[model samples]
Target: MSNVYIDQFPAEAKVIRAAFYSSFLALALGGVFGIIQTLHRTDFLRFMDSVDYYTVLTAHGVFLVISFTIFFLVGIFTWAVTTSLDRGLEDIRFTWGWYSLMAIGITMTGVAILAGFTDAIDMSASVLFTFYAPLQAHPLFYLGLVLFVVGTWVAGVDWFRSWWAWKAENPDERIPLPTFMVLTTMLMWYIATLGVAAAILLFLLPWSLGLIETVNPLLTRTLFWFFGHPVVYFWLMPAYMMWYVMLPKFSGGKLFSDPLARVVFVLFLILSVPTGIHHQYLDPGIAEGFKFIAMTNTMFLLLPSLLTAFTVVASMEHGARQRGGEGYFGWLKALPWRDPVFTGMALAGLMFAAAGFSGMINAGMNINYLVHNTFWVVGHFHLTVGTAVALTFMAVTYWFLPQVTGKALWSRSVALGQVVVWFVGMTFMSNAMHRAGLLGVPRRTAEPQYEGFEFQAAVGSIGELDAQIALGGVLLTISLGMFFANVVGTALNGRSDDLPANEYAGALSGPDDAPLVLDNLKLWTAIAVVLVIFAYTFPLLSIIDRGGLFGPEVIPFPLTVESATTLGFALETAASTSFESAGEIATSALTAVMR
Candidate 1:
């Protein structure tokens, strides 16, 4: 029998099991809301009232993007830390502490969102994941996220502590590849969390509590995006880790270049935070020059992803060749399609490649003007974090579960069918959404009201597109059910099976070939912080200059409950409320700051 996680360390297996359970629970809930929201968006299905649509959309975004994605990352990182270090956690009790904190945090936030369904509870957090003010959520939502983020930070420290202890004994050896990946990704996350934390504690949470009634809309928004953009990479990094480390094994090949892998991660740390301003290109408060700088940085950020595409493909090719395949592109046929783990990950990568092109357009200063806030943007991300990160997680679960549980998959065919259905569903849905977007169909609405003017599609009618999206959504939901059945059956398995070692492929050019500087995570982290400061300082100062602290006065409006006209902060400082009379407050603050 190949060495399994269960056979080697049974106690640790329980931790991984809890993590998986947490993950799939989120996947199940997220999958349900996702399909409902999709159907509602296309207008083919309309059970959710127009008023409640934003609530469901909030659930879809938070459950999938925040809860589902992060739970899986922590689980995968746990497995990575334990398996790579070849040592158990510092204490399983400590491990569960962070897990419980995260679970509690998610529940608190989830309650706030679900509470929005009824007026009986005045508490509601329908302010979607962005939480852009002068639209605010309940204080519980911010507190929940704080608990969640802090939990992750502690989890990182746990992993780092594990490595530090291991290194002391194995002083001569380099950090294991998995451990290295975990550490760097967590480091990036630690940096990323600072943005959101400050946004919450200093501003959003306080404002929601009525502790501070007003906040600079642009300042809070800038801070949110500061964390916002890097969190995308945070979501993608685990999938990328699987691609770099696990996909090659799935293909029966080894990693192509370990050194290049280090370089890719280092690039992400330095570039991800600085480029967040690109998300605000359409916003009014930020200057054109700052936007231009962000655009340039955003463009440079693509280079790492492009390099990743090249390296991942090369590694898969090497695996194909090792399996006795020959040909320029024909070697693709040699890949392990029979294994759901291999097929799901491969298809996820294919979708990500397309998502990448769309992202570049979104990053473009000029092109973004044509398609901002349309279903095209929705379609673009569904292919990325939605399909790419999410699909990869579902796929890896097939392989990782058995390793942790010491059992064979319940049914390989079911797992295979699950991934295929997901890819087919996303393809139909994403394509139609993209097409409709080009026809000027706006995104994120319940009814998508369109009686004023008929949207003429170049290739198909609106009815046809809606039908495709609805059909695709149904298929996707079925795929999620199939995934659940497979997981449940495997978890209840009565017998164990012999399996290959739970190990990733090594690189052709190993860590020995990589420069020593790549190991200096501290140096990289410091540089990353400096880059963030340099990029954000100017735009933030400009916003502050325009609006005083607590902002040049404004009123809060609930975006989900109010009409479109209500989105803006209605009154200028002259009519605005503050700690004192508006003029007194503005003049005093300006004088205090300048002095």
Candidate 2:
């Protein structure tokens, strides 16, 4: 009999399959919107009105980053907990409950965003992914996000429940590496989410529903970044878990060091939440000192990533050597290049190294000014979450789908081609984006070119960059199609009894080799909470003190063209009056002083 996951835990497998399907659905929706925006922005295709671009952008962002990635990782985490512990969920019903909550929540949020395309629904949420203040969305959007996050919170509880139960039975044993990873990540998430939860529940949600007259935009932004920056790691930790636990096995070697992996996760848990202020380096209201502190925290974050790089690469090398590969660089040939899982993850890691370099530039407050809110930032993230996280998930899906479904993969060749094509497409797209950003091109706009103004490229014409972006978009669309083809084909295939057993790599330096303190979850969580408090308490107080809890008498954003025009005129008039009053005051002060 095959020792696949389905055979071992049929009920849990079903839930995982459901989660994967949901993730794929979101990926499809997001991919469609992704191509639409890419083609429209590059002027290669203009089927939709430019006004609809923000709607498309919002959908693409929410569906992929919020829905797709989270849904998929939840499944992965559940699997990690179950497979590593050799136990089924304590309550299968509870598992289904959380998944259902997530599904319903995202569906509601998705509907609100899609409603932007039509006046028929009398609802719209064109607020992009950041959902920054003044760009208000419907209450349903906020409510739905609440439920989704809450569902994740419940999911975290489920993992903890499993760990606690396992600990009871194996009291003296160290926490399993995968479980340890999931727990640490969840702790970080819990801390990080407090910001967004406060932002939405206390401010954004009520404001959107007309319960509040106004909000401090800077305050809301600060709250968002507190959640925003760490959320990057939330998306990334699962990918890291896969890299640390699964990649070595696929490379034909055991993990190089379990202790190092635990330390990396611990570092991430402690450091991830406090560094979000770096995203707001250019924003007013926050002091430069706080921004500098955020920058310092962000730089410290690089240590965990570097450790990950060293440990994962070392594991891969050990695997290669075990396969009789000799010499330093020559051992690379011994890797299982034919396996989409290994190649995809390896390439993702390589791309992440590039992301790290660009990320440093972003973390540096001075250098960041050049690219803040520019296309370069967009390019940098595409390499990080776009490739590193997305590619790793897709590649691993080849292995995971069969395990869950009891079916053989339809075409390994197509799967391999999909990963390669995605890498190439992103290279073309991200490179052009970075180049354009360097030339002062702005992001989040449907039209980058103006009638009288032209962006002068150092080496190439703007037209060339547009072409590259369009080409990349087309190639990416093709890659997505290939990926879906494999998925559908596998779902249609008959059950196979020859599937590989469900397992992760063993460590050369096992958990026992590590100090007991490494597994002290309470100690690490305490430290993480302390760091977050230190990083955010003063900054939050300063923002509220300067900008009030409700802020100045600021008008809500204008949605209609007429309203926008009126607001513009009003702002211009107000500015003129203020300047005149300031001049009179100065004149009066000078006369009094002279007398």
Go through the candidates in order and give each one's C-alpha lDDT.
0.87, 0.93
Say which candidate scores most in lDDT: 2
lDDT of 1 by residue, 1-595 (tens): 4588787778878878887888788788888888888877777677878788888889889988998899889989988888888999988888889998998999999999989988898888888888888777888888999999888998998999899999899987778788888888898888877878988999889899999979988888888998999999999999999999999989988899998998898899888889889999999989999999999989999998999999999999999999988988899999999989999999999999999988988999999987888888888988999789989999999999998888888999999999999999999988888887888889878877667778877787989988988988998999999999999999888747676677778889899998888988889999999988888899999898998667967776665545444543433332466535867979999999999
For candidate 2, write residues 1-595 as lDDT tens digits: 5689999989999999999999999999999999999999998889988878889999999999999999999999999999999899999999999999999999999999999998788788888999997888999999999999999999999999999999999999999999999999999999999999999999999998899999999999999999999999999999999999999999999999999999999999999999999999889889999998998989999999999999999999999999988897999999999999999999899889989989999999999999999899988999999999999999999999999999999999999999999999999998898888888888999988899898987799889999998888888899999999999999999999888999999999999999999999999999999999899999999999999998876677625456558878998999999999999999999999999
Off by over 4 Å in 1: 559-595
Count clashing residue pairs in model 2. 0
TM-score of 1: 0.93
What's each prediction's TM-score?
0.93, 0.96
Error of 2 at 60 (Å): 0.5
User: Which candidate wins on TM-score?
Assistant: 2
TM-score of 2: 0.96
